[model samples]
Target: MSDFVLTTPVVLTIFNRAHLAKRVFEEIRRAKPTKLYVIADGPRPNHPYDKERCLAARAVVEAVDWDCQVFKNYSDDNLGCGRRTASGLDWVFSMEEQAIIFDDDCLPHQTLFRFYQEMLDRYRGDDRIVSISGNNYRFSGQRLHYSYHFSRFPHLWGWATWRDVWQRYYDFKINLWPEIRDNNWLTDIFGLVQAEAGPSSEVFKTICRDEDIRYWSRKFNIIHKEMWNTWDYQFFFMCFLQNGLAVLPNVNLVSNIGFGDEATHTCSVTELANVPTEPMTFPVLHPPFMIADAFADAYMQLIFNRSC
Candidate 1:
């Protein structure tokens, strides 16, 4: 473990992957945060092996021998990804004002904790900046004078946020979907033509129609159907709706290791899987002006379109 200790609280969400959970937990152990919150979902009733896997995963959290105040929000029943994660986050913000959140598959570099702590302190009162993300998927040579850039994409592989932002804007229900769609909120945020031509437009159309394509007969499988029912899209919707920006590190800090048969959503290996992490330099360079990088956003939209 390094001499550096994280002052910010960390919230980790884990399911039934013991090996991946242990790898991520080791990073958390290195940070040695003062407070740790573990949110876990119970095993699926249909899968016999899920129970044992879930137990093993939880044991990793219990094995933390560091001096920390650990909190748990393990569910007795499988609440699905949507309900379980949303409720777990609700519980987290209820107790803490702000926290750095992690999924079991998201392995962070040592500097990630320091970067989050500094960024959180720097933008604590800035409502415009709602989140700080550790993963930077853009591999382009686009260099910024700052250690981070403002983006519309709030990548949640590993991130940090304040309770005020979560409570005020993050809606699990997508309650504002109708109003947002009818009033052309997407167009307003990403330009009228871009919104109409992008993948987000398809998602907006789906949400507005409440069309359950589960039985649409054209879907490749049940996984494709379940993919639409995700909270990440809802969080992105919230960020767009609130005109909120997410700060992404200049260097990639987190690697995703959850793509396989056992994975819930990310079942296919992509270019983003297991990306090498690099340490971020201190005294973070700050952009002179607060504005989203259009080129980066366009590249991200391209990635989203391809992924869908």
Candidate 2:
């Protein structure tokens, strides 16, 4: 592979997963990025290893092998999931016009760096393209378009976006609860409600409903919410409300390797290894598509309940 320069900076949001955190840091180091934003979650009071893991995670970033600008947000107290992530992203947006955001669990292919560099430049001014994601799960069905497609979901695995879009984010489901319930937005956003919702659904949706920042995102009329999280189902809902689009690649550029039993969300036992490790080319085009209404319900019954 060849050296790739970033057109936009990269931001990494991490908690206390020291082992996976080390892998993420190493990937970035090998890619030789110019700038890196590290959002390290604070330790929980009375939690024995939380602080130690957080510090270990920080140490990995500090040991980046290349000449790079690193911004650290080592919180003094645990902010939990909502605040830690929301605040970390807020800080990243404040620093750069655009950034490729990552959570520690994700491991990028060697060429993902180059792919982002090219796509960020191509779609920077295009309001329709809200993000440049490292993961694309729809590669098999769709022929490769531009390495992404126009969707309503945010792929949290490893993704990129501009400050202009992030600035409009607010905790809509909370601050504007009346509007959300009145509009019946959650059902529409997530498609159909699941029969046996997973623990994370309640937690995730509760945050969406109660969190202040999320309410703001709903109210501000943000154009798109692109991410690599399996929660893309809900993301599709939020983005759909805004009438936004997502760019999905025909090739599976990104993969979720968080299937181990120790994982917070995905703890599947059946191992899926020996996958291809090549970066799909960019400028890939997407075909026409339709949103699956009951997709969320089926996913909950199939994936979340039995596995996670």
Candidate 3:
């Protein structure tokens, strides 16, 4: 029997996009998860829709009608980006063995439930495999088949991971510069490109800088030695160091929905609206390719050149 089920709690972190957050809520309802953990932070002062956003976010919970348990960690005072997000994540992983986490702007494909379930079951015992994520940017020659790919980047829009894997996660390092020095193994770990944030990284880091020092800088510290990445570029490094793999779907199973002005990050408004949402299958094809250190350096050069 498979340990996979569609009834697990889907954790959502919301901070003011009432409208888009509702869409995410409805999608979760369609899945009919057994439990739902909502961590909604209070809006920052001077921001528009301060009251409306909170009310709209709360309405999502009230609209739901089922045998669902909602656990809320609402902030009376705004904890900004760092404390609010990092603390909420700390609370969510405190309970379940695995979970499907999403921000307010992300919309899920109907099949995301099964995809997370199967990935959870497949890599349950593998400490090497830290997370199962949605949204792969490079689909040109990529297959719609189930296979593991490496990532050092963080793809927070939609992703899944085990609590055990998260237990090793310590999000606060104040300064990553020293960790770089302490860890001799990090020479190939964080190259110049991995040190800075690019298109998506910059957008998010800007929002988080006010609350947390900066997500990219924080992540650079985390992987300063060798840690799992759920961040944009950190995903690649995370997989490379562990020699882990990611399961990719045959079709584009997920899409990015955070391209609006209300979005804290990803407000560029790209043409990703046309991507199809298909459920991925299990028994994925494990790619033989491993992300080598040389490749990491080359990628860093390209990313740095393009961004600079």
Candidate 4:
């Protein structure tokens, strides 16, 4: 892996967790990306120690020892998760055409960088492919013969995307939700006639409705508010609207360490907390057809619900 240096730029999003940021930064140091973009949100006004903690987290990024060009986008006012991450990524794509993104707590395996680079190059011009994800929640002993599979779900624990796809997110147009919902656009996207005839019809319907009958509904609504401001969800909506697919690894590559007392969204210790990571083989074997794996996605939803 030493010979394969990661040439893609990395965009890292961080808040106030300096300890988790340090742990994630160590992995980034190992990859040694050519350019590092650090996006840090400002501390909340109410928390007395938030300013100090936010500064500490930013300091972790300053410890880059390798020869790399570093860029920083620090916010002066707390923008919360929705605005902070969305605006930060907007800044990133404005400068970079494509980049691998990591949250402060998403610790990736060494091969994760390589995987993103490879997939990004392979599908750079393919508009049908929107993003490359580093998560595989299929812990039920299901395995793919190929290196990765296609899905509509854009898992952002650790992921990569291009500017073209990211531009589709329109935060101000959230009021059009009533129009979109009333038009039954989801049925068209999922091809409900066909999906309903399939074995996983119910699962497909649930995904199309954005109704995770599990535990994420309340949390998602709280963060999203109007449902268009949240960065990752907006990205997912873009992919679905474009009939796009996201590349998902056959094995888990990111271990989320943010679920704890300090986390904003991930405050509970669930099955996804600090999940283990594994190396991915080079020269990936692509799936024959670009289609969402329904069974795998259903299983993923189940696991997420259980965690919540």
Candidate 5:
């Protein structure tokens, strides 16, 4: 890890959680990336306490002592989850060609910086690989010999992506979902999984079925209607739309500590809350080919079916 240098910019999205932001900032400070982009949503007018808390959270990033150019994108109005995240990334890519992203609650192992830097470099020109995620759901006991595997699901607890991928695929308003939905275009992406096989083996069929498809279809319709204050679903929709895969580490690299009353979305303690992180073994053993592990993807689908 000594040879690792995080030339890629780092994007940290924060809200009214000074304590959590401070903790995440410690790691960012440790990584000492050359460029740091901090995105903050303004305090909600209804929550009288939000102003002080939001300012405190924004203050933590000011402790940057290292040689770094810190960029701040602070909003005066409350944009909620969807608009804030989408617009933040938009501001980031507008300047950077690529960036490693973090929500203040998603703490990362030190190795994550190295992992993202390398993955982003390796797949920089590859359009089929949309994004790289730091989270490993750990749904199954099986382990892979490589450092990471391809996944259709890009978990955003901690993640990275190229500017081109985001600008081309993601839509904050989800304006195209209706067109895709009306034409039943989503089936073209996962249709093979519903068949006897897809990507590699029959397990894909076992894991992704009509029920799973319907679950996602329902999700698309819901997010398309803006039922939830989220931006990730639309990102995943773009991944499927372009037949792209995300690179997910073999082990969990991020632990979400942002659960409890202060959290907007993750307000309750769940299995995903504060999961442990393990450092990725460096000089990553790349899979001989780029293919989603069907068995693993199957388990991932099952977990979504159960959890969502």
Candidate 6:
């Protein structure tokens, strides 16, 4: 589709990875989004080389050659991932109603821009749908009748969302996590029975599902407690709170390529790192009904439980 033009706004969040940021920015350049917003975190004072690396990463956006309006929200002092991204996005949605988001590490396929644009238009007023995800964590394919399926989880590597979802659901402070955890509300939210973890095969399956609940429960505690800090958990908090669904494509559209010493969470190689993305063919088929694929979500839960 040579005539295809991207009109949606795009947001890029970058820290100190110049190389990875450049890779992501190049694809955005190709997509030629009409409006581009960049959010950059300042360098850590403790890290000796953070300033230079951060500056280099910020400069990558200066190479934008297309005719696009670019807005920048740069921090002079480090706000860390959680604060920087939350504050950055607050600035982004203030200017536009909806936009696709990317981290420095998330390399997007050309088709992702079109896919997200269509989803934004089709589901503009659908309050049940909170985000549009470009990630399919399963390396092995999950058979589906449509081009995409609804997901209970929010994958932030490369995703899109509207101002309503962002303003209403996203809790950077994770204020409600404690009440959910204390009252054991996740089971109700997930529609899962309160099955205890056991070893039997049928029970083992239930246990795995419970592990998914526990995995997020523990994560929320950590994020709220400041034991670990990042942006995704807070996004997920509102999704879980509202039982919101993210539209996940059948084919992977974004690849995480920043796995190295300089990386934060992706410090070591894992199956998720450098996941190869393939083009999603045209005339995307939307699912006839709006329902989360339980089989796919369960399978993903089993995979995610391995880390927990």
Mark the regions of model 5 whose C-alpha exceeds 4 Å error after superposition. 193-208
RMSD of each: 6.6, 9.8, 9.7, 4.6, 4.3, 4.3
lDDT of each: 0.81, 0.59, 0.62, 0.81, 0.87, 0.87
Query: For residues 195-233, could you state the per-residue lDDT of candidate 1 as single tens digits?
Result: 245655532232321121211112223223454445666
In the range 285-304, model 4's lDDT, one tens digit per residue, is 88888878877876776666
Angstrom error of the Cα, residue 170, model 6: value is: 1.0
Range of the 10 consecutive residues with the lowest summed lDDT in candidate 5: 201-210
TM-scores, one per candidate:
0.87, 0.71, 0.72, 0.87, 0.91, 0.92
Give the Cα error of residue 5 in candidate 3, in Å: 3.9
| Candidate 4 ranges with C-alpha deviation above 4 Å | 169-175, 187-191, 194-229, 304-308
Compose the digit string of candidate 6's lDDT tens values, residues 1-308.
68888999999999999998999999999999999999999989889899999999999999988899999999999998888998999999888999999999999999999999999999998988999999886655687868898988778899999998998778887988878888878767765454455676334222235666778888888999988868888888888788789999998899999877878777777777888898888899887898887877777777677756
Worst 10 residues of 1 by lDDT: 209-218
The deviation in Å at residue 112 for candidate 5 is: 0.4
lDDT of 6: 0.87
Candidate 2 weakest ten by summed lDDT = 223-232
lDDT string, candidate 3, 194-231, tens digits? 33567666532111112122333444655554453233
Q: After superposition, how far is residue 165 of candidate 4 from its true place, in Å?
A: 0.9
Alpha carbon RMSD to native, model 4: 4.6
Better by TM-score, candidate 5 or 4: 5
Pick the winner on TM-score between candidates 1 and 2.
1
**Top-TM-score candidate index:** 6
Q: What tens digits encode model 2's per-residue C-alpha lDDT throughout 165-249?
A: 6666433223344576567665545443434567665423322223322443353333223222222333333455565554444
Which tens-of-lDDT digit does each residue in 178-199 have in candidate 5? 8887886666666653446546
Clashing pairs in 5: none
> Which has the higher lDDT value, candidate number 2 or candidate number 6?
6
